[model samples]
Target chain A: MSQMEIKNITKKFADVTALDNVTLKLEENKIYGLLGRNGAGKTTLLNLITNRIFPTDGEILVDGESVIENDSALSKLYFMTENNYYPEHMTVKKAFTWTKGFYTDFDIEYASELCEKFSLKLSQKIKTLSTGYTSIFKMILALSCNVPFVLLDEPVLGLDANHRDLFYKELLKNYSEKPKTIIISTHLIEEAAEIIEDVIIIKSGKLILKESVESVLSQGYAITGSISAVDSFTAGKNVLGADTIGGLKSAYILGHLDKSGIPEGLEVTKPDLQKLFIHMTNR
Target chain B: MSQMEIKNITKKFADVTALDNVTLKLEENKIYGLLGRNGAGKTTLLNLITNRIFPTDGEILVDGESVIENDSALSKLYFMTENNYYPEHMTVKKAFTWTKGFYTDFDIEYASELCEKFSLKLSQKIKTLSTGYTSIFKMILALSCNVPFVLLDEPVLGLDANHRDLFYKELLKNYSEKPKTIIISTHLIEEAAEIIEDVIIIKSGKLILKESVESVLSQGYAITGSISAVDSFTAGKNVLGADTIGGLKSAYILGHLDKSGIPEGLEVTKPDLQKLFIHMTNR
Candidate 1:
């Protein structure tokens, strides 16, 4: 098991501030959903943790050891970036051999099995692969890397519906056999909501929320009723947002709902993760 | 309004066949979901319809006229391809102008409005934009083209949850106002299910199913109960798939599910679009 800590981390690029004094601790063997709007600094934080880039301020540590210039500490982590960095001429088979050299603990046999499972040809050149195959190749490497901490950035970029389902199921199966701290930075929040145990949200380079998925979700409730009645009931309440269609209205509230005080003809249900994320992240 | 007819289209690349003997009619003023697995020839079909590539056999027509070298027929259609074909140094403003030349009906004001809504700067160069911004730029063009037939491929590739929500809502708003024939070829089936009136599924270069989304979902159901009861009840039914956790079991069944005939402990519910697509496309 491994834990990662970010202490008051801030990253600056030229004149822009990418991440601002963000501090969070990742528990051991937990799946985390790193979510934010575009350019909200999710990638910047992940890059800092992997030592690909340095923070303008603050410290990042894995197991109390700084990852900066620390080969041993970095070796225990695998960061599957959005961009492919393998040699263009390298075949999948050769790439596996080459990655095993750096990741030492990488299971070559398991990688071959995954390649077959995804129907990827080992002899196919990296540059010849389609966008979907390119993502699959990188995912296969991350899964077989045998690292204590793995970071996946938009893991299912071009995958089809069936392939995405297979990837999620395989991810769960692998996590069950060998627990690891996995952080997935993706825009597909609903697809990852159930699989991820914890959620970390950032906005405009600031950490807004960090909590278990269930606890964060428990704070949101949706009430549906006539527009006038909903407006009357939700006046001055912590209403996140609302949608109205003709005479009907659905208001999303961000606090506990008293069941006894509820108006008749009103319906209350749990808002979905994606809807909650949108309401929280919308400008 | 415009209609597209794909008559016995087949495409071949070298020794491999991409699309084989596919025939389907895209009705006027309806949103259709073009769904398939990766390498299932969804893109090939779209490319053929747009005259980007020629079909090896049969023909494609837009408004009852052949699209091959037919400028008037092609002018009514807009295909938002997966790749960005604009010049590397072209600004978003310039790209909008260039597109307007070919697509004379392009609405420059609406394009600028969409750019503002998405926070995309007109001065930013196309090659300098991020993945999310790139997708947003293309989507803005597709929505503001003012064409009678619009085809979008993976329109929300890297959009965040908030942006995707905005896009879907905008798409529906635009469709309601313009009432054009639109075909969305995307991997996010569940997100597109409600907006898409009909679904056209293909498997291994062959047309598999074409029906209304409601009709397809109505034909499938999910049953949940104890393992023994689920297995016994599904023994003679056409079971698509099942999942078991400890003593609990959930089985997916096809065909009509008689409400009163269901076992007492079992629960029946409609299957989601993603689940149904996965079952249909999985090997």
Candidate 2:
């Protein structure tokens, strides 16, 4: 029953505000989708939590205890970053050994198993691995650390289709066996939609929405029909966006749908997460 | 109509073969999805076409002429490579001027227009942009070059969902206005599936698939039902793969499916591009 709380956090880098009066409570044993556009402060927020940088104002607490240079509280978290963690000449085996010092529950056997599954050789130097393999290596470290809170940033950055599928399945399997609070920030919204339970969306360094995936998805829908029919149906509603092809049209609406009020030729379907994200952050 | 032919191409690096004997014909004015896993020789093929790398044993011809050390033949092509084209500290405007020297049809006005649309400042240094902006810069160059053959490598690497959508729309519009041969090498299959006219899948330095998207997608299907029912229906058939969850099962088939022959309680769906790709290249 662990929980992390950010109380009115504000981060500023010189004149630019990276995060503005953002507050959120993250509970344990759940997967979160941290979504935002590039330079929207997703990475900045993550950095603040991991003590890589200090917020201009605010208090962060884990289980009611502050997480400022407090090794015990910080030990529960693992951040899988984009930058290389190990030196160029260090082998995967050596990096595993180095990680064991920081992570109390680091599982070397599980790491070896993952390497075998991914066909990554432990003897190979960190710099020799391809982009996809580098991502795999980082993912292995994050999953094998056995930490309570895991932050994955663009985990599938260079992975192919099969590897991506494998990574998702493995992540789910690991979560099911040992439930932990996981946060994944990625641009591949559609692929990671099903894996995420709750979503936390930010725009321009400001918290916009935080809700369960089901509730968010249920609130928005797209209607396709003749231009006139589609326009009439969405005219007064909270229209998100619209696209037209000749006399046909599809309009995205963010509100309750009256099932019986639909026009004869109109077809309604749930809008995908990407469409919703684009519309929400476009401004 | 312009056409490029890769005839019996074979590339070797010291002791290892980078690309096996491969032959294919690429027609003009079509978008080709060049897909493969890492180290699958996709980049090798592109380099060979650009005459940046030589084939160990084969000939490449564009418009019935050799492309080896031929400036006139190479002038018709523009390669948006992963390596930085401009030296460090070079501005976007300066790079455009340098490109105009090589690419005869490089349109400075169109490049400026694209920079405005993509929100890329012409005066900004190439090295100072973020990952996403770097991608946008390259995409603008590829689209504005007006080359007969444009090869784009991971064009949407760091783009957000909104930017990715904009880039795809812009690409389609550009292609429609001026028809040319465009080959995109990317790992994001599902998003680009609809935009591609044909798919070229390479695996382990060999050409495994070369077919129109329509034919390849139409050939595969998935059936879901009870485990026993699915097994019975797919037994001894051209089954690609299957997944089972308790008593329920879904099997992917590679050949034509008899709709009427499907079991009474079974459901069917067209298999997506990734599923087919995973099954084809897993070995």
Candidate 3:
């Protein structure tokens, strides 16, 4: 098992500071959701970890070894970025062969099976593939690479409803069969909430929250009732936000609910990850 | 007020038929969700309506006037495509000015206001924006175009969870203030379900279902319980799909669920739009 440690990493590009003193530990064999708003430095941090761009300060280590052009450590990692790296004219079949050359552990048979499931023709050129198919091609490679550490950035970018569902199920099945350290960076928070074991939320180039999914979800909830009743009930509580519709109101409050002291018309329910994320990051 | 009428429209590309005798109506001041699998011809239909491409058969009319080569009818419509069309070196402010020339009803003040709300700088060039920002810029244009008929193709494509939440809220607000015929085509069905008044689903270049959101969602539900219990309960019903985890099973069923005589341990809940779309479109 391999663990990645990002320590005090900082990156600046001309006038903007992309990342500032960001540090996090990616444990072995776990599914993590790296979440943030646009330009919040989620991609910057990922690029730093993959050694694509050098950090201005601090360092990244994989299994206690720095990941700065270290071929041995890099070989165990696979990053499926949003941009296509293969030649536009290359056939899907040839791209698979080329990928196998770099990652000797790549499973050709499994890739072919996935292709069949996704209805991707091996003879089709990469450039001719639609947006959805391009995403499928990259996802198939990411899943079949057989690396200890895998990073997927917006893995389901252009996938349709059915294909996205299929991808999630297949991903879970593959993970169960062979446990690996997986970090997924995506904008679809609700779809990924149930699948990710842990979550890391960053805002304005700084890490705001990092915790297990269960605990984070349990930490906050929504209470809805009459406007006056809700306002009085949440007087001293940490309220994130609220919405009013006529005489009714819904207030999102942080902290556990007391079952006995709740008012008659008020209803409390668990907040979904997307709602919580919006409240947390909506500055 | 304006209504879009698609009359037996058919489109072909070389040997492939993109759309096959599809007909639909967009009522004035209503929001419609245009949904389908990839390559199902959702974009083609939108393109045909906007006169971007000629239909091989039939015609499209806006408020009793043909759309083809009709500048007056076309002026009431705006189509926000997936690809960016603005000049690469043009600033966002300049693009806003350019759009006003073509779209006489374009609101420059509203566009600038939305840019501030989304934290998009007016001085930023179109080509230099990130994927999320690019989507935001286009969305701003669509919203401020002030046309009676507006078509948004993947408007929230790369937006984050917070931005997506904001976009939906803003869309609802804008629609409420000045009602228009809005057609949104996207893959995130559940997110758009509440905001969209009606749904139009296409499959393999043919129209499959067109109904109100309430009616479609109420037609199906999911029952979850022990494997044997779920199996016996859903034996004769229309089962869409099933998920099994150990001894427990969850089966998605179509048609109205009978309230009485349900199994003791089985729990019934609503089936989301995405689930219904998958079942409807899956071969």
Candidate 4:
């Protein structure tokens, strides 16, 4: 059974249509990348799924039941946003206690362990932690919540390289131990490409493409060679983007070409997620 | 002559030595990555150079003279921080006009063009712009300033994919037309690696490595093959990191190996800047 399903969902704010006839089915035990440019309605779709906002039209079902204002259904999901709201004068320990009451699966022991790993001070007030620390605190809550579905929107905003790598490793470890559905909305595509099993690309409030990560990347190839050779080879192909400097040229093509057809001294490589996204969206 | 020079720079905050006798030279017409883990004193160093704060020991020379309180030398540099402090009543156009007085090379026409390209309203007050637009406003100032030295500390913090790509392309175009000494401090290493000519890695408030980009990546290689073949090849080698799935293994090894020595059915590639930075700092 699908963990979450949105059928013909549409959300409008006055003259702005944030989402238009968006239909998506999220499976269980997989990592999905929710990607798009700014103002592409990725956040709107996520908010609708989490019931933070209601859809203007159509229906959303969680476990085959309407989710609007449904406590039992909402309890099965955890949604973490870029900006977290914490009450004033609340210490880390108090926040943990508060979340424990709301989430039955909240593991205080695991949360405490994560705090220690991230070197967070349990006694410090929520407002006293640095931006990166605040993110860690929220991540701890999300991970220990142990919900069937978790949604993270730009979770690594303020983290450094080491901390980001650590977060990814911990996420994978937790997933292996307790399989669940994860939807991550982020701009750092290449970094998360390996972990994401599927991808959903949104553009201008419309769903552009939704497919497995492997299938998405397999549709494009990057070719580099002399300017003349590259220009000739890319003549009739669907060129996503091209960069040229002096006599060297590199073009991202929509379809793969046979190895024998590529010119000598030219380099043909697989397109990274970032390159593909840039090419696809820019076009 | 160097655009900026740091001689025996040391900063101490009570018992903490934030920067430890660091000395470096920044030449003109190059982009340098001022990279390090959090609390590595990158912000402190930039503050010292910009004369916003004084160093505990040593000196910063701009154009062969100390820049402390010297308006003539300081006006040649522009530093864009995470938070821009413009009066709430100030409009975008007014901010541009005010910046013209501080920067001798400020170009109003160019600023207007960028404002349009970023879809910014000139009449909108600074407080009315969204977080992403605020960043774009600051970026416009930095680019249009045409200063000899530009320093950006996490300038692309909240930007989405399309805007970030636009920023990179604009930065490169500006650099190619008007070369300057630019230092960007960011956690997104791989995104910036292609644009930066030099890299400076810092750790624990100490300089770890500073070299050309090619030289840094030349020391590490990534090898992928069958689990057994990968394990045997990486044996006795400095394995910075490794990822395994089923029978396939990918190992990041220190030091380069001859192409002929690579095992059959194995793929050897260069390590990405982000991965390399994480491995280096974690170790």
Chain B TM-scores, listed for every candidate in order, come to 0.93, 0.95, 0.91, 0.89
Q: For residues A113-195, what per-residue lDDT tens digits would candidate 4 score against the true structure? A: 98888788889998888888888888888889989999998878789988988899889988999899999999888888988
Give the distance in Å from residue B24's predicted Cα in candidate 3 to where it truly belongs: 1.7
Give the winner by TM-score.
Answer: 2
Interface quality of candidate 4 as DockQ:
0.67
Per-residue CA lDDT of model 1 for B5-104, tens digit only, reads 8999888999888998999998999999999998899999989988999989999998899999889888988999987899879999999999998888
Q: How does each model score on lDDT? A: 0.90, 0.91, 0.91, 0.87
Off by over 4 Å in 4: A222-269, B222-269
Error of 2 at B214 (Å): 1.7
> What is the CAPRI rating of model 1's predicted complex?
high
Model 3 residue runs over 4 Å out of place are: A224-237, A241-250, A261-267, B223-251, B261-267
lDDT of 3 by residue, A146-197 (tens): 9999999999999999999989999999999989999999989999997999
For candidate 3, what is the DockQ?
A: 0.84
**Using TM-score as the measure, what is the rank order of every candidate, best first?**
2, 1, 3, 4
Candidate 3 displacement at residue A82 in angstroms: 2.0
